[model samples]
Target: MAALQTRALSKSYGSRLAVDRLDLEVERAELFGFLGPNGAGKTTTIRMALGLIAPTNGSVEILGLDVRRHRSEVLPRVGALVESPALYGYLSGRDNLRVIGSQLGRVSEKRIDEVLEIVGLKGRDRDRVRTYSMGMKQRLGLGIALLNNPELLILDEPANGLDPAGIVEMRDLLRNLAAEGKTVFISSHVLSEVQQICTRVAIINHGRLVRLAPVAELLQDGGEFEVKVDQPDELVAALKRQQWGGEARSEDGLVITAAPDGRGRSLIKFLVDNGFTPDAVSARHRDLEEIFLTLTEDPVK
Candidate 1:
């Protein structure tokens, strides 16, 4: 079953449309990345899915429950940390978790400790949040969200304030959560991070759905093979003679889409027979950044 789905969902404010006829589905236990640029309606779509805001049209479903009709029933099983971390500065990390846990009924102190540890804050649980670093505060916010042991976790830019080490830790924590059967839906403008962490991705541009697919498949479509040869002109000529169409340019190398049926080896052999030795032959997959820039370069009407 899909953990979350949006069916032709749209949101508008007066004359401005934020999200437009968006359709997406995230499989159970999958880490689905939602990627878009600023003003691409990523946050608006997230708010609609969480029932934090009403959609102007269409519907959102969480675990088969309609977000609009069953928000109370659906929300409790989901945890979310959107945009920035909101925490009480005066409260210690442990106290913050305790406060959130209290609202979810009587949660034990042990459970709080477990969540703190999961976020790599076990040793700093007693420290006041004001003394915590930005990354630490972010982790604490995540801990608060996890207090109820939610089945679905939605995080928007979870790595925003994290350092390199902290980002790695956050990635591991997310992976572990998914391993434990939790569905993770994350929104990030950091395409490289999303490419590294998410198994599947849904891209949005100009408030409309662009594509949704496995990360590998998405990369495959944009995959290009770079071939550098000593005789660039001759290589281009030979390739054109054989009707092997590709974009050949001077300066660096020739970039061509990978053969559909894995005939790259044959192409290399053809190059060798034509007296051109390729200096480097490498397969390049488009990262999230490349895909985002390409897709969002022009506004959708």
Candidate 2:
């Protein structure tokens, strides 16, 4: 069963559609990335997924149970850290967890300790939340979500306010969670981090999905290759002659063009066959940020 799924899920505030038939499925144990620009209805979708707000149309399923119909049973199996965790500043970190734990029912002292350690707030759990840094507070919030040891985690901007080290730690922690067979769905503007951690990604713009693909597949920009050749200009001229290589160009002392049959070996053979020995040949990769901008900038139909 899919850990989380949305079938034509949509939400609107009167005439304005915030989310439009957004369909997505995150398989069990998958590390999934949900990406969008500001005002793209990501939060609205999340709210509906958590059953905080009902969808205007369609439905959401968590672990194969309809969220609207089985909210009680579905919510317990899911842990979420939304836009910002509501935390009492005056309370110590451990006390904060203790308080939320009470509402979660039967959370043990050992489990609390484990959550603190997992979120990297072990020794500092005694510190007041008011005195903690933004990153520390974020960790504490994540700790609260983890108190129940949920099977699915849905997080929004989890690395918000985190320092470089904190970001790396969070990345490692999330990877470890997925490795241990937990499903993690993350919504964030941090494209670089998402590229590294998420296996599959879904991008939405104008409340509609524009792309859904594996990170590797999304980064592969039409099988183009970057070749460091001695005669870049000559190579470009020769490549542009072929029907498959009409888009060939010389950029930054490199011959940039699509490979013959989208294979590196074929491109290498072509180069050698055409008397243009390449110093190096590598498949060109587009940055996730670049791809994100390209997809979201154009309004989805």
Candidate 3:
């Protein structure tokens, strides 16, 4: 069974629809990414999935159990950190974990040690949370989420406030979790990190899913090629004259234009045939950030 699935899930406030009829399925042990612009209802959808709010329509299931109908059975198997994590400033990190662990039933000290080590807080686990940096606090929040050893983890901007080193660590940690047969669903604005970590991504816009595909598929070539020619302006002007290269433009001395039939060889043949001898030519792969902006710029019809 899928670790997480939604069928026509939707929500609204008065007459304003926050989430449209959305359908999604995240396989077990998959590292899935959820992306959207501000006010796109990402958080609202998450809240409904976690049973924190009632959906205006449809249903959400966690591990084959309806979240709203089986809250007691489903919540224990899931861990989540949405937006800012609430923490006690006066308490040490270890004590905070201990307190939450107690509520989850009998949790051992060895398990606490493991959680501390996993979050890179072994030595500093006893430090007061108030004295920790923003990154440290974020790590502590993650540690708390892992205390129960959940089968599914849903994190919202988990890398918030992390430094470069911390970001790398978070990436590795999440990958390891998925390797260990845990389903990880993440929602964040960090497109680069999402591109690196998630195998598949679903992008929502105007409370509707606009795109869903593998990360590699989404980052594939969009028929654009970069040509490092001597006279970039002249080359750009010439390329624009062609019906196939009207979108051509010069950036950083490189003439970028669409290739006929979306092939690099076709572009090279055209350039050579037109006497615009190219110094270098290569296909340009669109990144997740660029694709994201293009998808979210307008509402889906």
Best by lDDT: 2
Better of 1 and 2 by TM-score: 2
lDDT-superior candidate, 1 or 2: 2
Instruction: After superposing candidate 3 on the true structure, give the runs of residues whose Cα lies further than 4 Å from its correct spot.
Output: 298-301
Model 3 per-residue lDDT tens digits across residues 1-301: 9999999999999999999999999999999999999999899999998999999999999999999999989988898888877788999999999998888888899999999999999999888999999999999989988989999999989999999999999999999999999999999999999999999999998799989899988887366888998889988999899999999999888888998888889999999998989999987778999999988986443
Q: Order of candidates by lDDT, top first?
A: 2, 3, 1
Model 2 C-alpha lDDT per residue in residues 215-274, reported as the tens digit of each score: 999999678999998888888999999989999998889889998888999999998898
Error of 3 at 142 (Å): 0.4
TM-score of each: 0.91, 0.95, 0.92
Listed per model in order, the count of residue pairs whose N, CA or C atoms clash below 3 Å is 0, 0, 0
Candidate 1 Cα outliers beyond 4 Å, as residue runs: 240-246, 250-262, 277-280, 299-301
Q: Please report, as a residue range, the 10-residue window in candidate 1 with the lowest summed lDDT.
A: 253-262
2 against 3, candidate with superior lDDT: 2
Q: Rate the local accuracy (lDDT) of all candidates.
A: 0.85, 0.93, 0.92
